[model samples]
Target: MEFRHLGRSGLIISEIAYGNWLTHGSQVEQETATACIRAALDAGITTFDTADVYAETRAETVLGQGLKGERRAGLELLTKVYFPAGPGRNDRGLSRKHIMESIDGSLRRLQTDYIDLYQAHRYDHSTPLEETMDAFADVVRSGKALYIGVSEWTAEQIRAAHALARELHIPLVSNQPQYSALWRVIEAEVVPASEELGLGQVVWSPIAQGVLTGKYLPGARLPASTRARDDKGGAASVARWLRNDVLERVQQLKPLAAEAGLSLAQLAVAWVLQNSNVSAAIIGASRPEQVTENVKAAGVKLDAGLLKRMDEILTPVAMFDPAITAEASPQTRP
Candidate 1:
């Protein structure tokens, strides 16, 4: 597996990070989840990303079990906060209370004392940014987490946080955002800001939640057992890319994938890694073979011309508006 330094930080992580978002502890059985994690490790993936809120905190336990025998020093484990992990008013957001309590809970669930990179799952409009960053600083100082990051944060939010992170002398090294060939919202604003601030992007949904895999054909009935048919949150997460227009446009990339000698999914994953600022592309899987297949994109380099053709085909349907980044975060805590 190819490895890159996460942002300007000294920490090196695998380019292909295996993430359990909708699969582990929810859509797939624990056995399947562990098998996928093993597959990722077999394929040389050392980075694992999860969240405390995934499957209401069960995902971390499953992941912890999956990594039981592995040397902790060899893996880069990442998780997030700021989502409602519990029912109480004090159970969520980036407030000092929640951050302090949540870190201990995550450490317990993850079966690790120190998270490699702990992130804010989303921006908390209700909490002061200073309170959040200060809490993160304490988490680092306490040695519960090595570095801190934020997910789906706007460029301005990132800039403000980076200034505070510098002031606090903590390593705020990465930004986790939804990025893929179909989702280019981060390119216009977030990328530039993060690049300037010494932050790298560990992008999620590099295949647009399987839309870029060409599995959902235009006008076709929802494929049996596919993400679109999932009753779980997967369906809603991938709903925007299931439109006929988007599906039809996605189909045009088949020949390009063939020419590049890559599966549609590999093409999609590699497309994101082509950006210099992207440190890693997060891929989630229910099956072990899927993990093996997608990891091939790790060190694959796509020519500039092939990338251009992909853009021409997908640009019309792609969501590139910079405003979309800000829109992605909730105005108030959920």
Candidate 2:
């Protein structure tokens, strides 16, 4: 596996990471989860990302059990705070109380003394950005978090945090956002802001939540075991008409991948990592076999011609500026 600096920090992370957003807690049993984590480690995936809100808070514990003993030492574990963990008024957002209280639980659940990176899951409209930054800075100061980052933040919000971190002399490392062949809003603004801020992007949804994998097809039923099949919350409904066209576009890439001697998945991942600014592509998988395929993609650097071919594959749809920016990408790992 290739390694990259985790957003200009001295800390090095694997080029392809295994994250537990859905599979560990929602889809797989402990046995399968153990195998998947082992597959990632064996493939040299050093990072494992989870969140406080995933699988009703069971993903972390599953990941903890999965990464026991000698294996734990080889991983850079990351988790996020600020989400509705419960029905209480104080159960969500980036309040200091929540931030402080949440990390301890995450640590315990992750079975670690310190998280390699801790991120705000989303932008909290109610909390002051400075307050959030100060609270995050404290996490680094207290040694509970090795680095601080934000997920799916707007360009302005990222700029605000970057400026505040500078004024306060706090080091903010990365921004996790959705970037894929099918979705390119980050290319417009967030990517530029992140570049200016000396922060690297560890992009999530690099495959458009499986759309880029060429799963759904025109005039076909939803795959019984995919994210789109599990979409009861209007997620699958958001791009009903557009998705068919996108899937058709993905089908065109199969021949390109065939000629390149790579799977379409590898081609998609390599396309995301093609940009120099990307630190790593977070690869989440349901089965252990998927980890190997995804990890190989990290090394499949696409040439300029291949990228142009890929653009032709997607056919340039209108940009997707998501509200919530990150949807936990449910079945995201699956």
Candidate 3:
């Protein structure tokens, strides 16, 4: 797999990162999740991203078991905090207590002494940014985490945090945002600010949660066993893209993908990677073959003309409003 340096940091990561968000420990069986991880490794993926909040912390344990025997030095493991991982009031947010405690818990669950990149899952409005950054600083100094980042943070939030991170001498190298051909919210503001701040993007949902795979046809019934029909959070997460307008627009890109000799999913993933500031695209899977199929997007270059055609087809339905980033985050801790 091709690799890129995250932001201006010295640490390099695989372009296609294996992520377990809604699948492991929740939707998919542990055996299937483990097989997907193995498939990712077999496809030369060395980066893995997860969160303590995923499946109420079970995702990390499953991932740890999946990577149990791999050489730790060869993998770039990433996890996040700032969500309610527990019932207590202090069990969430980016408060010093949560950051400190979360790090240890994540390390324990992941079966690793240190995490390569520890991110704030969302901006914790209730906590002072200073407190959060200071806690992250301590986490790095203590060697529990090597670098720090934020997810779904606004450009203004990123700028403020970057200043604080710089003052504290921390390596705030990346932001994890939901970015895809159909979700261009990060392009307008977040990308420019992150570029200025020396932060690379490790984008998630590069296929718009499978909407861009051309599986959900317009005017069609919800496909059996698809994410749109999932009773779990997946259904809600993908609900916005299930509309006929969006689904119909997605269908127009299928031929473009075919002309590029890529599956719809590969085109979607490659579309995101075309951004020079995007260091990696996070892909989640329920089956091992899905992992194998999506990883082909890695190192695949789409011509400018094909990319232009893709934009023309998807732009009308794409969500590009910069405010969506802040709206997606909790105004107060959940």
Q: For residues 288-325, what per-residue lDDT tens digits would candidate 2 score against the true structure?
A: 99998888886676778877877876746635564434
Candidate 3, run of 10 with poorest lDDT: 228-237
Please report, in order, the local distance difference test score of every candidate based on alpha carbons: 0.94, 0.79, 0.94
After superposing candidate 1 on the true structure, give the runs of residues whose Cα lies further than 4 Å from its correct spot: none
TM-score of candidate 3 against the unseen true structure? 0.99
Tell me the tens digit of each residue's lDDT in model 1 across 54-150: 9999999999999998999999999999899999998988899999999999999989989999999999999999999999999999999999999
Residue pairs that clash (backbone atoms under 3 angstroms), model 2: none
Give lDDT for model 1. Answer: 0.94
Candidate 3 C-alpha lDDT tens digits along 1-334 = 8999999999999999999999999998789999999999999999999999999999999999999999999999999998899999999999999999999999999999999999999998898999999999999999999999999999999999999999999999999999998889899999999999899999999999899999998898888989889878488889998899998888888799899899999999999999999999999999999999999999998999998888888888888899999986787889
Q: How many pairs of residues collide in each model?
A: 0, 0, 0
lDDT assessment of candidate 3? 0.94
Candidate 2 scores a C-alpha RMSD against the true structure in Å of 3.8
- Alpha carbon lDDT of residue 127, candidate 2? 80
